[model samples]
Structure formats: C-alpha cells, structure tokens
Target: MLSANEIEQVYWLADSLGEPGQRIDDGLFLARVAMHARELPRNLRRFLADFRASNRSPACLVLGYPVDEVRMGPSPTACNRLREKTIDEIRLEIAAILISSCLGDVFGWRLQHEGSIIHDLAPRPEHEDVGLGTGSRQHINWHTEDSFHPYRADYVGLFCVRNSHRVATTIGALDPDQLSKRHRRLLSAPLFTFRPDPSYLMSKAHPLPGTDRGGILFGDPENLCLRFDQDYIDWPDDIDGIAEAVETLRRVIEASLIHMPLRSGDFLLLNNRRAVHGRPAFTPTYRGTDRWLKRINITRNLERSRRRRQSDFDRVIYV
Candidate 1:
C-alpha cells in the first residue's frame, strides 16, 4: 500500500505535528495528505476511490506499510492510561488519518470508547465480558459500528500496530439475492429497534432506548445496507412474525461469514453500513506485546452529523 518514499513522507508528516492526540484542524491536515496521496501507489488510490464511491464490500485491507517496531514499544494495557504522544503511535495514526481522508471526515462518538477521534483497541482483561473491544474471553458479537445510532460512521478504519499471534477479525456480509423473499421483506420494514450498548452507558446505568423503530435493511434493494446488533436488538415477544424474520436474517449472515487476520502495518477499512464485524474469543496476555489496533470512524459528509454534535467543526458527537 505504501512505497519506501511514501512511508518516509508520512513519517515526516507525523514529525511535523506539534502535539499528539490533541485534535488538529483536520481540514488543513487533510489538505496536506490529499496533496501527498497522489504520490502513493496507484492501486491504493484506486481502492480508496472505489470504496468511497460505494458501500458494498465488508472491508478493504492495505498491507505492507511500515510500523516502527522499536518505537511502538509494547501495546498499552489501557487506552485511557496512555496518551498517543509516542513517535510510533503518532506515525501509525497519521497513516490512518491519511487513508481516512481519502474516504471522508473522521469522527468519534462522545459517549463511546475514550471519546477520542483516534482510539486504541487493545485487550483489557478487566472488561472481558463487556460489550466493548477490551473484552477478550467473550467474542465481540458482529454488528455494524455504533449500530444503535442513526448517525453511525460510514466506514470504520482499523490500523494494526502489533498482532504477533494472528487474531481473526470476523465479518458477515450477505447480498440481497441470498436472502429469502420473506426475510428480505421483513428486514426492509420498520420492525427493528436497538438498545444502547454498554459503550453508551455509565458503569451501572440501565439501558436506554438507542433508536426509534427503523428498518434493519436500507438503501437500494439490489445493494441493501445493514443495521444490526444481535446482542442489543430488541424484538417484541408478541411479534412472532418479525422475530422469525430476524432469526432467518441472522442465519443467512452467519453462513456467509469471512474472517481476516490483520498483521502489523495493515489497515482494514470496513463499510459500516454494508457489513457487520466482530472478533472471536481470544485469550490475551496483558503484557506489553499484546495485540493492539488503532481505530477511527469516517463519515462521508461532515454536515450530515452536525445536529448530533455541538458544531459542524466538532468531530465528537454527543448524541
């Protein structure tokens, strides 16, 4: 995905940054990346172009980029404890930000993860059973990123800095032609609702209504977009018909699953509206060398989510 010269250029960009983790004027930063992006490999530019044009595939992987092994050190045990000021971390983030700029504006949810636009995804033993990425023992069930929210990201970008033991990232995607006639009709109807996942709540707070009645399948019928969370979806007991449909949809999605193991210097960008992604239960050694990934959310348009955040310029959405 990156040539030797291109990698050097990216590192230079990272070095030029005055502060790490402190949100920059992304508009200006994006402009710089846009200028340098032309110097990147042709195939990479085409891949980003195709992905931005449509949301069809589960993900696009960019491999062979450089990761400064010595500078990255060990993966942080907790995202909150570490600031992204390290040289390697900033370089990795700059790489991600540059790739994301090709797709859209990068945004973050104020109530989720660390509320940082660029966040870490490393196993935290203490949250093994929680719904967040820190859960290690329990597989994080497949779902669209921020499935409970209407203004979810258009694409989710993940940059792997370290993953010595290949841990598989699971993805489920089903074409409309694969769905049964009845199942397709039901999912297209407004019969589904999602509860706020644990990520949206405080430690002991009760679950809140996350979305109004909405269709699980949206967009063009030929290339339907998905919105689902098996663990957080709320189905009325009395509505047996919709319940059966949901179950059928789940079966089809599971049957078409694809798993990919990301290695260092690989960035996997997923179309959040087109597929659901999760991870298998993998034991983690909280030691510094544990698997670590940096993630960011991208939206096609910044104005569409202005109502959710304090201002159009703000990247974090409180709602």
Candidate 2:
C-alpha cells in the first residue's frame, strides 16, 4: 500500500499522460508509456527492483492507486475484445504497464486475446465455465501462467478495476528445497507434458494442439523456478509413483494456498515462474459492474522467444 502522498504521485503520473490516443500496439504509444515510467515514485521502483532481485516465489500487492469505478464502463462481453477500449480502461493500462515495464519486457500470446499485451479479465456470461481468467461460475484451477509453452511469462501483473462480487484469488508456492533429494530429482526429470489450455485453443486461427515437456523445477538451486498445471499434465500412467509424487506436491500447494480478495485500486504482481494462482467460482451480477482486472505478462528474456515472434519489436509470440 502506498502512502496518501505516494498514491497522489502515482495518479499524477497517469494524469500527465493526457489521453492514450493511439492503440496499445502502436510503437509510439508504447514508447510513451515506458518513458513516463521514469517518473514513477522512487519507493515503488526500489521495491520492484528488490523483488526482482529475490528471484524466488513471491507475491506483492500495492493498494491505494486510484480507480474511477463509475467512470469505468461495464465489464466487457465475451466476444472478440480487439475493439476500442474506454478512456478509463486505457488510463489503467498506461499506469499498470508502466509499473510492469520496471520488471521486464511485457508480451502476450498470439493465441490469447489476439496477441494482446494488456488483457482485460472479466466475467463473460458465455464463458462462465471456461478455465481462463474470464471464468466466473467455475473455479479456475491453480497453474503457472502459459504453462504449456516454454516461453511462459516470468511475472504476471494484475490491476483491479472493480470487484463488486468480492471474488478471491487463490495462490500457493512450492520450493523444491522443501523436498528430499530423491523427490527433487524425480521432479526435476523431464517426465511431464502440458497441453495448451482453453485460453489459447480459443484463438480464431485455431492453432494445432501441441504438447510441451519439461521438468517441474529448473534454474539455480537457491532460486528455483517451477512449471505446473494440474489440468493439462499428461504423465505416463505406468510411471511408478508419479501420481504419488504429484499428490505430494499438490498437498503442499493446497496447504499453502491463500485467498486474496482484491478491491478497486489494488495491484497484484505474481511470480509466474514459482507461484500458481487461481480463482474460486462466484455468481456474477452481469450488471456491467462485474469484477474486472487488467493483466500483463512479463518475460526477462524477450529474445528467447525470437523464433515465436515475428520481428524484433513484436512482443506477441506466434505458435
């Protein structure tokens, strides 16, 4: 949470960026947002720097940022959301992405929201039971963001526009160091496969379904990263004790899972590499005032996905 003065400083920065006259994908528009990030409150920048340095599973929340609920239009419908966004929507994206730029290069998937860098997540009556973020009537499962792809995000930033229903997001973390050497070795083996979730499958191009296989734990031993998605894993049933191993890890995550209810003006950042997040099912009012959140995905090494990107400046990854 920011102090009153700090909150004012943050809002002032957003206000200074007049109207976002250009589309989000426009080069000049994105440059303008990143340039303005130079003026963010010093404490906020310092805190983000420290969090990045930790290189461990962590979740941080910032409250007291201004969000004009009345000014924000109703939650977007379930159709293709590639059209124009309201002024309030653009304002929040500018502020949200500004904070995100401090972490790393933000990117999106071609199969999700039409390569949207900034995503609007809200309940859509047509997709109430979907496993994606727009889900409302069904509990979204705990999983790493874009778990099926090696180019998955390193961090995920979410800014709440509104949460009239008070839905709670569940998050849990697992450190490989907590397990025995044998268990750690088992998890580190490339014995698991993950398929693309419905979010990517819904793309208009209807990309061919593909599977990705990798170890659950990788990276430096002291600052381990994880990749997990219970719904899409396809481990060999004949593998001895694989189920037990998965159950063991699941239990740890279940025990550690915590419920966080976000409200207007709250911003949540999750370590997508280590933290698994989900949301419980909730009834929606659909009164144009349903829960709404703006989301962005950040990767420390954008170049690593060059094969999947069209050009140097293109942040949208192709399958």
Candidate 3:
C-alpha cells in the first residue's frame, strides 16, 4: 500500500496532462508518469517478489488514480476506439512497468473486448437472464477464470475505467488454515471432473486441447487451489460423496472470503493459482453507466517456474 501523499501525487501527475472534459493522451500521460515515478517500477516488482516468496495471503496493489465520476454513461466507447494510439501506448507503458516491477518474467499483454472477444463471466440479458446475472444477485460465488484450461494465466490484471456502480465488489477467498478434515480429503481425492460448457465447446478457441476429462482442482492438498465452474463440471455418476464434497468446499470459501471494490484508475493484480475472484452481479441498463473494466493476462516466465517454454508467444484466450 502506498501513502496518501504518494497516491495524490500519482493522480496529480495524471490530471496535469488533460482538461476536465478532454481526454488525456494515455501514451503521453503514461510516459510522463513513468519519467516522474521511475522508482515505482522497481518498488512494485520487489513487493510482488516478496509477497510470493513469503506465501502469505492474497494482496491487492491499488494504483492511486482518483475515480472519475462524470463519465458514468451506461456504454462508453469501445476501449480500442477511445483513443487508439494513446490506449495502446498506455498499455505498453503499463506492461513494461509490470514486467520491470513484478516478481514474474513478462510474456506479453493482450487486450480483451466485452462481447465475443472475452468471456462475460456473469450472465447478460443478451445471453441468458438466469443464473449469475439476476441483477439483484449479490454474491458472485467462488471460482477461477477459465479454470478448465490447462494453460491458465499465472497472474491476472483488471484495470478499471468506469465504476459508477460502487456496488460492484470483487471478493477473494484466502482462508487456507480453516479447511475441514472432510474438505481436505475431498480436495485430495480425484473425485471432481471438469468439462467445457456446451456452448463454449464449439467456439473457435477451445480452452484445453482435448475434450472434457480435465481435473477440477490442482496444487497442494493442504493449500488447496480450485478450477471449477458449477455449470461446466460433470461429477461421476458413481461418485457417492460428490454432493458433500461440493458443499464442504463452498462453506470453506464463503467463510474465508475478502471483499474489495475497484474504483477508477485502480489496477488489481492477483496470483491466479493462489486466489479465486468474482464480482457481484450488476444491473446493466445499457445506459453507458454500467461498470466497465479492462482485463490483461500474464504468464510468469516458465524458466523461472523451473519449466520449459511451450511457445515463443504465450497463447491465451481473452473471454
């Protein structure tokens, strides 16, 4: 966490470049900030390295930009179209900063769109009206993003641009010590099965190479990690304790959850393997005032992970 003065300095630097109603050139703004905050890159990297080395609970690195309240339209311009050159420039700057500052080796940064380009984790009225997108729903339930994929990201970044709906909260689960004996046994047992959601199976980018038969969870049993989507998993027909296992795991996650809301200009980076995150359902009136967030995926250096590099380009699907 940075001090109040440091936070204010960051905002002041960003605000100095553009007028209240004018859009700041993201690229120039980032370059200027980077020049002034040269130490920031190294400091952030050290923090990430130490955090990972200690194996402590999940942490949130909130950037100091003040929330922009005036631009609360339901549907803002597409991220790519907002200020094309500036957007790409800022993205590159941010990516460079992360690579220079974080614990992991930087692979690459890819931008995701809201529709077919990225997965809308929550149900939308245009898609389905039930399940996770019931407008009034509060809890997002615990789950990893695209867990069925064997090549999931090592770290995930969410950059907020519009968050007028302060109710959109991101909750993370971190209580490893409270796992019950039953929960431990089930997590260790290979009873859970994962399959691609039917609708997602035929899509151009199938997560894993093969058809279903993916493991629902991975990592050490004592410090469990999960990759499960309730709608996509397929429990074995003969599995006797499936129901109990699911219930026990849910209980543990709910009891240990931590909530954080992202305001404008806040960037949240999380260890995908160690933490599971989800957001409360938000009412999207298509009025341009709905919550909007930009997402980026990063793969830690395989050499650093003590593993061989699979490809020159770290392949990832946005949705």
By TM-score, the best candidate is 2
Model 3 backbone overlap count: 9
In model 2, the clashing pairs are none
| lDDT assessment of candidate 3 | 0.49
Candidate 3 lDDT, tens digit per residue, 265-297?
666776776667776655565555666565545
Model 1, span 1-319: residue lDDT tens: 6677666765676556535564433545555654665554566678799977866777888777788766888777765624546755666676778778778878887666645777778888777676577767788888888787877889999888888888888888867787777878888887677777776775333233356568889888888888898988776677547888888788888997888888999899888988789998888888887778888899888788788777656677766
Tens digit per residue, CA lDDT, model 2, 184-232: 6777789988888988777669554498988887777766778899998
Total backbone collisions, model 2: 0
Candidate 2's C-alpha runs over 4 A off are 18-20, 79-82
After superposition, the stretches of candidate 3 with alpha carbons farther than 4 Å from their true spots are 3-41, 66-140, 174-176, 197-217, 302-311, 314-319
Report the candidate with higher TM-score, 2 versus 3: 2
Query: Residue 58, candidate 3: how far off, in angstroms?
Result: 2.7
Give the TM-score ranking, best first.
Answer: 2, 1, 3
Candidate ranking (lDDT, best to worst) = 2, 1, 3
Scanning candidate 3 in windows of ten residues, the lowest lDDT window is 109-118
Per-prediction RMSD in angstroms? Answer: 2.8, 1.7, 6.4
